[model samples]
Target: MQVNNDRLTLAVAKAPQIYLAGVIDADAPQRFESMMRSGKIANGSDIYLNASGADLHAGIALGRLFRQGSMVTHLGTQRRQRGAPAKPALCTDACVYAYLGGLYRWAPTGADRIGFPAQMAVDPKASADPDDTSAYLKEMDIDQSALAPLLTAAHADPAWLPADQLIAARIANNGRLPLTATYQVQNGEPYLTLAEVKRGGQHRMSLECRRDGVLFTAYNAVGAEHAKQIVAHGARSFVEVNHAESYPPQQDYATVQDDAVVIARTYPGAQLGSLISATTLGAWVRDRNSMLRYGFEFELGGLDHILRKYYQACWEYAPWQVAKKS
Candidate 1:
């Protein structure tokens, strides 16, 4: 696996007194109360992971590569353009708001669920022996004729292919055999054709053997490091509480680049604008898995209020020092 761990760091000026209160355990409460009474708390610099931008970029790149030449009827645009094209009219503010607002409304609740815009099970009636094949084709709407060659190449040598590649090939072939007539010969036999076997007992032996062979090769091709990288990259974004600023500038955050994850830091001065900015920053770093892990530093006046209220209140604090580990 290739791991690129470069990272970028951004520094925001934070309120000094609030930052000081965070470091002194014994004096924290008194200092916090004093600041609150004096109304001296002001806007403080906050650190953000900027992972959303990364995710959006990744989505865009992947879309560009995979969805090229595709047309979106509603958008009145093609995924790619050969030359300058007329700009489509903007969607109405109400329509745009409704569409975007719905996405946000459902995002948190739907995070745990796996969603596919198009998913379909194998049509048992369409297959002669569905049990023997058990292959489910997705994206059946895609023109199979355009995808046949890729599938044929992939099926010719499954050993070198990844599961995603295999799935893509299967989808491209419209759920049929992914081979051409040219490469069907193996040991003077037609390897491309499905062979007839006795039903039940004797058939079970051949099926078991074939399954074992597949499992063996699949396991052989998958490396432990590669699997680890995949899991790291796929980890869901987490909100880190209390351990804010523990991250070592860009270096510590960069450690997760291979994993495609990021940590967003929240502090006493956090507001809606800062939060939104941090979230957007975390989302922008794309080399990693396109997820942001948010970190919130706990202190007085930083919690309990709505996002907009919190932002308004936090802007009154003085610049403070961010604690660092010696």
Candidate 2:
């Protein structure tokens, strides 16, 4: 509710933006179902698929293509959602985040190399029927060399190396460059982007970068649009809270660090509620005290109980609506 560009500095103060896309073979659906039932794919795990084997190879090929590129962080396989038994449904969500973060790219063309050893197939009924067969296979052997074209196609023309590799190379090339970029957005508001740079006694690059609003604005816009879409699609969530005083503090408040803002929201039932400081809610409250004040709604028990439970709840139901003048 209180949009504090200042708090964007906290490590966990800001919401993470993600963009995802995937290519899965026909059998991938069945394979994913099997994996879900067998516990091979759990909740919150990052998964990728290629309709054609090409993209699958490209994903794995990243390891070799960016051998010197260490900036790219690889997330491991996460567990599938509790109710969903389909692989595509789960992997799609994961890929969106990876793609938005610029950590992932899928091939425009797919190679239906279903027989590839790296492929994994799920057979939900495999146990019941001994002959039940699934074409899915998990790719274990990643041929980095085979990935060159797929990577190139998935990315913009004159394709850069994989994101992880590119970030690594950028870091290696410029010792002064920051390792990560921070992003933030308020509903119906302009987005903000910030980077952590090394500040020198006489030559502060960070200051220079901030002063160049044009560059920062452009970068922020890119990240902003990407974050917006991700949030709209239910791929990523955001929260606003009071800044914790100590490391891993028990209090539920958002905080800022050098160049990031982190907010946390926990869902009690179906509705997600955020614990925010009064200071943070000042901005939204300044305008109106109505329920529609915040950019989004806190759907705890739906509209029926919104008013009744809102004031009684300890955490603010919708702080974004309470606006305060800077």
lDDT against true structure, model 2: 0.26
RMSD of each: 31.1, 21.9
lDDT against the true structure, each candidate: 0.23, 0.26
The C-alpha stretches of model 2 lying farther than 4 A from their native spots are: 1-24, 46-160, 163-326
User: What's the lDDT for residue 233 in model 2?
Assistant: 35
Model 1, 1-326: lDDT tens digits are 01111232112321121111001123323443454446443222111110111122222221221222121111122213558763332222111111111100111111111111111112334555322112212222333343345435544421122324424533312112222111132332212111111111010000001111100000111234543454355443332213222221222221232322223332332122333223211111123545543221212132223323323322322212111111
Model 1: runs farther than 4 Å from truth? 1-262, 266-280, 284-307, 313-326
Q: Per-prediction TM-score, please?
A: 0.16, 0.18
Model 1 — which ten-residue stretch has the worst lDDT? 199-208
